[model samples]
Target: MNDSDRNPIEDTRFGEITVRQDGQNGLEVEGEGIPRVTLERDPESEVDRQIAIGTRDPDRLTMRIDGLEVGLKPAKGGLTRRSYRVDVEYRGADYRLVPDSVPGSRLTRDGVHIGDFSCDGDEIVLAEWKEGADIRPEDASIGYALASAFGTGGQPMWMLLIDAVGLATP
Candidate 1:
């Protein structure tokens, strides 16, 4: 069979974000309820426009995981499978977000770097914070970034992220 006949693989899905590895080694994703999420390298710069399953167009990815159906899924891909990652900086600290699994660690809405929130094996360190005090203004922005980062993978957590940051999930 020709290379054109090959297909890509969907790597991960946490909340609303889904990761797919194009057979060509390219990575893409689909954003479910996030209306304004995009690849922005820097907050001060324009977002990096590109292709994703539903990040830009939700209806575009329907046929999608709807109807709440489940069945035998394909085995996990090789270690080298391509995927996407996002980085967020809040309160002078940076966090890397990847499509893995987290054991439900609670990150404060005020941006506290308590420890690492692990997804499968990958994780990001949150900067430590003050003990019981109203968060600074920048902390709100941090909360939003963390939520957006985590929301790129699954469902309920995505809503959690939105609520944590006061950003609308729809």
Candidate 2:
């Protein structure tokens, strides 16, 4: 998948995005006319340090991230097909980000169920106004346990956008 035209590295851009493919895995995006960009998708961040009763606790968390699914349709004479699904649980709520089904409602990547979108010349706005039901664990301490259990975390939005743009561009 590495193109020779990309001498030292393979890179492509659309608008303000410059992407470099990561073999068959995914893409790395950068600003077109700027330095590298790091997208911070962690709502609570990797670590929150403060005095917990004049002390401190090392904060940790993990996200249940799934891999991409791709295949070929049998009935369509070997036509290629792809689907993207991302599941994230934060603050006792489940956030699922998948492709907009042809007959489905709207949702954003940040786990907003009911929302509105507006467009201008070169900008898009997305919002979820509905206060959906809250999801909680059986035991309140389970969240904390799981949070500290995983040393690393998953970046769902980063995965979705990188996969979508990478697969589509090249």
Query: What is residue 62's positional error in candidate 1, in angstroms?
Result: 24
* Cα-based RMSD of candidate 2: 19.2
Which residue pairs collide, candidate 2?
Answer: none
Question: TM-score for all predictions?
Answer: 0.23, 0.23
Q: Native-vs-model 2 lDDT?
A: 0.26
* TM-score of structure candidate 1: 0.23
lDDT for each candidate structure:
0.30, 0.26
Q: Which ten contiguous residues of candidate 1 have the minimum total lDDT?
A: 68-77
Candidate 1 ranges with C-alpha deviation above 4 Å? 1-86, 90-92, 96-134, 152-170
Residues 90-139 of candidate 1 have per-residue lDDT tens digits of: 33454433333333323333243422232321112222333554444333
Tens-digit lDDT track of model 2 for 1-170: 13323322121111232323322222222333333321111234333232111111112212221121211111111111112222334344443333343212232324545322121101112222335533222111111111122111223455657878999995
